[model samples]
Target: MLMSPTVRSGTLVMLIALLRSPATTVAVPPPSSVQASAIGADVTAGKHLFERHCAVCHGIEGKGGRGPGLNRAQLAHAPDDTALKSVISDGISPDMPAGWFLTDEDVANLAAYVRSFSNIPSEPLPGDAVRGAGVYAKGGCSNCHIVAGAGFGYGPELSNIGIRRSAPYIRKAIVKPGATMPEGFLLVEAITPSGDKIEGIRVNEDTFSIQIKDATGQFHSLRKQDLKELQKLRGESPMPSYGGVFNTSELDDLVAYLASLRGKQ
Candidate 1:
């Protein structure tokens, strides 16, 4: 039936109002199987890339070896997806080199694969954390290491060692300190023109000057020309082997104590 112009306009207005109302329902389509497959393929490709480029340092399963572990839900440096991608592309200085060869899509896929490691369950620790604390105290570990700003700063700050290192890695480190003498902790001996020998960890070095922090936590800045001798004790670590210091159970307890120290949060 034919309607007047005013009646038709009123009907159209009512229809528009109804569509805009809260009661209105709209169906959104789920992602297609093909799209899902593409995503899966990207992740697979990323895993391959990681194996080729990152596995040397990060391990086959991202459990870590020379570099820090990526199996946890959170990464200290790369907290979010965007940050993760940036790290993969740019890399951390001194220790980690940048992925200058990776394309943008390659970086995305690598990030995806790294993120997948977070879903895997963390390995359970066996030692009692409380007992481990006592073991640590008895071992004189605070003489060199620092935890949550409590101990000496001669060694690396271990506030986030739990997140950075795996249980096996920590165990090995405790038993054989020389095996995993952290990067950048190079020992050196310098003999000045005055015939005084100073031995310590090399803090920083440049073209003109070198800095050293001795066993007593003293800093020495010397010019390269003024020194009679500057010897880099490569493949040597001042941190002694504790293999004979602690029994098996005590070692396990120490590992647990160190593992439980997952930063402020």
Candidate 2:
């Protein structure tokens, strides 16, 4: 059951206080202790249990569905195995509920299973970044995407995209731009009373008002009541897909160049 707003506020206040209480807070449990506890724990049993219980939100492989992927970087909340074990047992408020029904050994087993996916993996690209830069320029990639301030202030900045996203993800984004529209970049078509239609990617929105930036780099601010029609297009980007634009080798070169862009222009 969800907590009432009043109860939630009080709980949040208490949590903040506890987080700030250096003297009252207990020491972080050691990863070694968690490992020792799970030395004889059945990982296969844990996987089965996880699929039955946690797979809906977190994928069967812990790759994330409704929740963040477990197979990524170190978890921000639970930095170590000891902390993770506690989180699994107690759970976080609001989003995660306490696992009071789970036995200590069961929680330990889950923790062990979860721990196995924390390794970060990277694939090496075969194409040359130098040649890829030329292809990027020819394809007018910089017109919308900014790499070290080379392009217009439209679309997503790609200066540090190499560090932010994986190579495979980048390739998918290029081939299918509208497949997964990014957050805060949802395409919206707003029509005014006099049959004036404004199509743009939303910048910000609230219950009362919305702000959108058009392809022409113009920002439109309008009240909810003023708009005759407001449509939100999910999984849609303004950028055209490069599915047929680039050949097989050029695509590989472009991806390679993008992957090589750690931070430079």
Top-scoring candidate (lDDT): 1
lDDT against the true structure, per candidate, is 0.78, 0.71
Pairs in steric clash, model 2: none
lDDT of 1 by residue, 96-123 (tens): 7799999987987788678778767766
Q: In model 1, which range of ten residues has the least summed lDDT?
A: 32-41
Model 1 stretches astray by more than 4 angstroms: 1-41
Q: Could you give candidate 2's per-residue lDDT for residues 1-265 as a string of tens digits?
A: 1112244655645644554467643542343633443444445567777897777656788765434456745665567767877887786643455678888778877886776666534345777788889899999988788898788756877786664445666788889987644444588999987878998878889999999888777999989898899999877788898989999889889988986675642
Supply the global lDDT for candidate 1.
0.78
Could you tell me the lDDT of residue 169 within candidate 2? 64
lDDT of 1 at 160: 77
TM-score of each: 0.80, 0.58
Give the TM-score comparing model 2 with the true structure, all chains together: 0.58
Per-model tally of clashing residue pairs: 0, 0
Model 2 Cα RMSD, 1 decimal: 11.7
